[model samples]
Target: MTLAPQPYLNTRVSAMSERLLTSDQIAALCELSLPDLAERFGLEALLDEQLDRRTKSRAVKQALINTLLDELRVLIRPMNATEAGLVLAWGRKYALFNLKTLLRGQLYELDQSEISANLYELPAHVRLPQQELFRAEGVLELLRKLEQGPYSLIARQGREVFEQKREPFALEAALDQRYYGEMVRRLLQVSNQDGNELKQLLGAVLDRVGLLWLLRFRFSYGLSPSETYYQLVPSVRLLHRDRLLRLVNLETFDEILAALPEPLTSRLAGSTSLMEVQRRLGGHVTDEARRTLANGQSGVARALAYLILREHGVLALFSIVQGQLLGLPRELIEIAVEVSEPNCPADSLADAA
Candidate 1:
């Protein structure tokens, strides 16, 4: 008989969770000066800690992203093959962002140096051949090269958009749909107890993303209902396939919101705009992540939850830091941070319900 893989010893992750800021702590940090904020977070060591506002802001932002990647390295170190693969694939989302940047740079014939300056280096496993991709003669060739890589699913979707001569907006939507679809499939294949817990949190996130994207593409961008349906991530959460299809066909935002299923129907009730729904879902995801980090099994599940929440903390800090650098008022910075790191009152909702 085949032996089972050992569960991860997630002690480091549990300890690391304590390092993330509480919501109150984040709000408190918003009151600090930029220099004080950087020092409080111990971000001085990550970058040059420069004097120029623009340069310092970029360094701080890069430091935040780099910290996430460093933590990700530690988290992915002890997982079994499947679990590691899933986490590593999650990391590739960054690579896709770089891919789009590179594609646009090439398409518009932007200076190579300018494009190169914008690219981030993901770890080797997730890193595509950037130099080779950059050398490709045209957008079609870039897609062709991407098709030969591990991210062929998303690349194929991009290629189809190119072939059809769709707008850049449509191409981006197609690539995102494929990327999230593959992730949902991977999450479904993970059968461990911890996997199930992680899936509940991640599935909720996917639901939010898919619903938000559906609303934007259908109503905001004026895509037809069928076009909107085709653009959505393949979701199996609160907003599953049939639910999303029903949503796309609805004539207006209120109609779709009214038709929304259980928890969402409750959570997003009386929300005036897509932005409100997004903020409400942001809080919902934050609540689920915090609960998971506190109470879930100590393994990849908790580790991933910690990373998710940590990213939120970083975003809140990043926004405050940038706002202060720009000398924005306390009120505007608070507003931005609230939207960035929304937290809701504790409530009972069935996982994967």
Candidate 2:
């Protein structure tokens, strides 16, 4: 189904985009103490009613995420089903996150309450079967339950990967591959200008994800070329199947970087560490989203651009809160909050929360 541009929705998204937090504002907020932060951000009521000061970082982060989701829900509420579907497609990432959490928690035998506590309370229309997932006895049982749901394909793939390797990384990687693949497939079904713009944005995202996965799997996880290739999302922009095969076969990170396409090579220059690579890629994505929001004609594209910015803002805040909770230096906190880096290590502030 084609999702035509809705002028009213586009205008509303543009207005909402204007209200998003600036990097400087986020930086300044990061410097404040919990009470000061609440007062400064006008979140005192939310803080007092929903969050404990002792675990302020997690509480504040979740509250911000919920606020973002609520805003997106309102923005899309007036649109027709097809237009709403286009916007909600982006939010599927959150559903995937919840599924991954449930699967991992089940695999590790974590308590259902603990898993549920970490899951986001998505809008009713987009919500997943959290209760059913939480009640599953094991990963196999969870997969069995999900096989007939929206996440059926991913569940099946994750189950296959788990059976083959019994490794969480492989399972998670498979889920990610499935998520991006489905995103691209769905975008292709929309034959319109907005669809093309969104495809470009998603293409860049896929490239970044592929590069990061390649580096981590080869260098960090010590996976072989074949194994690394197995984890990658099939052919996107910069790293198409041929290039990916070539890069995976490369011996060192330097060689792999050298083999990259022009824009990425230039963008990633001097990114000596994994964190640096992630930081640069995050900057690229942020810039792309802003460009789309400014120039995009389609309502879905503009709304998606706003959603990207909003999600990044929330993530930046999360990083700042994490740094603060960990008693990190202000300079370090600023660096962490400057970009929207995802899949942070388990020891990060967000994880602890």
lDDT of each: 0.77, 0.75
Give the runs in model 2 whose Cα sits over 4 Å from its true position.
1-5, 45-54, 78-83, 339-353
| Top TM-score prediction, candidate number | 1
Off by over 4 Å in 1: 1-8, 45-52, 339-353
Residue-level error in angstroms, candidate 1, position 178? 1.5
With a 3 Å backbone cut-off (N, CA, C), the pairs that clash in candidate 1 are none
Model 2: worst 10 consecutive residues (lDDT sum): 344-353
TM-scores for all candidates: the values are 0.89, 0.87
lDDT of 2 by residue, 1-353 (tens): 23456677777987788778887788677768755766765555435655454456656666786777788798777765655765676677788888888877877888777876777777665678887776777888887788886778778888888889898877888888887877767666665786788776777777888888888888877899998998887544678888999999999877888889978899988666666677678778778888888888777777778888899887876676667667787777776786234334422111100
Candidate 1 has an lDDT of 0.77
Instruction: Give candidates' CA RMSD values in order.
Output: 5.1, 4.2
